[model samples]
Target: MTTSSAPPVAPAPETASTKDPATRPRRRGRTGKPPSALLSRAGVTALLALATLYTLLPLTWLLLSSTKSREDLFGTNGFAPGDEMHLAENLRHLFTADDGIYLRWVLNTVAYAGVGSLLASVFSVAAGYAFDKLTFPGKERLFSLVLLGVMVPGTAMAIPLYLLAAEAGLVNTFWSVFVPGLVFPFGVYLARVFSAAYVPDEVLEAARMDGASEFRAFCRIALPMLAPGFVTIFLFQFTQIWNSFFLPLVMLSDQDLYPVNLGLYVWYSSALSQGHPEDYLLAVVGSLVSVAPLIAVFLMLQRFWKSGMTAGAIK
Candidate 1:
């Protein structure tokens, strides 16, 4: 009478989709052959090759041109190395000529770009985070002003900015380049994007509720989250300041304060008109040297950009 065995557990029901054998992954086609993966791989390889060539074109030209002397620049194959290797000779001329003035120009460029971008990044992050999370009067209006400033080309404001600097006795000085660079509208905009994407509002609120001051919460919690954004802003501002020629051209008359770009312009102009045509090699080499640091920076810090985008996307 006690032979009641537990009823067999009902077989687990399969979903309609799972029950269809045709829906299963197949290892072979109807002809007992594997699918061709070459087309997709070939397409990707071709695309990568094209992209590599496109990006390397300018750098290739710079490299080849740097190797050529005045005569070889036009006389030899545009992409080929010259018969004589004068990189050392050209560099010697660059450093020794004019009592080592090129070194001064290099220092000035470093000062302007390195220091200015650092300060600009800080200002942009602070402003951007404030705009994103903090409530204040006319915040939107202020951000709108920044947007308007972005639309207004830097060249358009060059005269006005120079005049303002002149009035303040800042023109033709290091301040003329560094001070103006610190006010980066595009950096602010990028910072705002990063802040919005990465820094969560709730985290700030929770920190505040725990008796943290506004500044304390930002410094402790939000600031760390914004590292990626800050890095991006720094890189962008760095590049902008590094490549800036026209602003320093108009604002500063002192050769000692000239950034590399403006300094290179001087060399190019001198080579063409007043100086030896052989100096053309120096100009090309100088141009190449000016860009090398930026290239190094990009290569070194590119991971931050990728991480920032990933973190922002996940947030």
Candidate 2:
């Protein structure tokens, strides 16, 4: 091969047109097969519709039942309108019955829930802020105790609280209900989480460097930022105090000091035991009236509430 006279030719690089169809890489695009039908848009929409129906059912029944007279209440369908509307008449009877004790109960409920929730929110936020920003001895241990409190149900604590109230000569008094409502362990936890998520440490440091006292920084800086959390805590505590029955039942024997929930219970019991259908009607209407404030409060603060609820999940 006397030096293989001609140089060997190199192989040509593959091109798209020259590549074999079986060897070519497939481009990423839609396939002929469709995705699984599970969790599709239609399925999600149906699930939401079902949830909405479930939630609205009771409220719808309550609204319809509130308009019915005693006869219509038992005679007609629960979800349908009555033969005649007795809403105005029912409200009149509700407010006037028992010398308008219902109004007093309403006021008591407002006071207990409003004042207690406000104070509780303030205290919780302050404690939570301290827990988050300020370091102290036994901080984790103290917080562990708070977490422990969150694990304990309110109903379980009712007996112990009643005993403490009795010991302090506070039973059957407003303080019995109002004082206990102020200690919200879960609210404290919620506020702490909110503080950690919402309040920036650098901002506090800047305030401190500018000669602001700790308390001043908290009030003027941290508080405004924590407004949503404050509203969240207030609403939670308000709803709890509003719906509380067992605690009031254990603490209060005087009907005059009763909250709306306990007062309505008394009316229902009287109706059942004393054969007073009018009392039953009063209880029904009173229940509807009692729910209105909660609805109004939620509607008003929903923006803040929604923001507060989602704050921890973001960061």
- Tens digits of per-residue lDDT, candidate 2, 1-315, equal 366567889999989756778767555438745554557798888889999999888777777888999988877888878533488888888888889999999999999999999999999999999999999999989999999999999999999998898889999999999999999999999999989988888889989999999999999988988999999999999999999999999999899999999999998999999998888878888888899999999999988855643335324
Model 1 ranges with Cα > 4 A deviation: 1-51, 83-85, 308-315
**Candidate that would win on lDDT:** 2
Question: For each candidate, how many residue pairs have backbone atoms clashing (under 3 Å)?
Answer: 0, 0
How much does each candidate deviate from the true structure in C-alpha RMSD?
7.4, 6.0
Residue runs of model 2 more than 4 Å from their true location after superposition: 1-38, 83-85, 306-315
Predicted structure 2, TM vs. truth: 0.85
Show the lowest summed lDDT stretch of 10 residues, model 1: 306-315
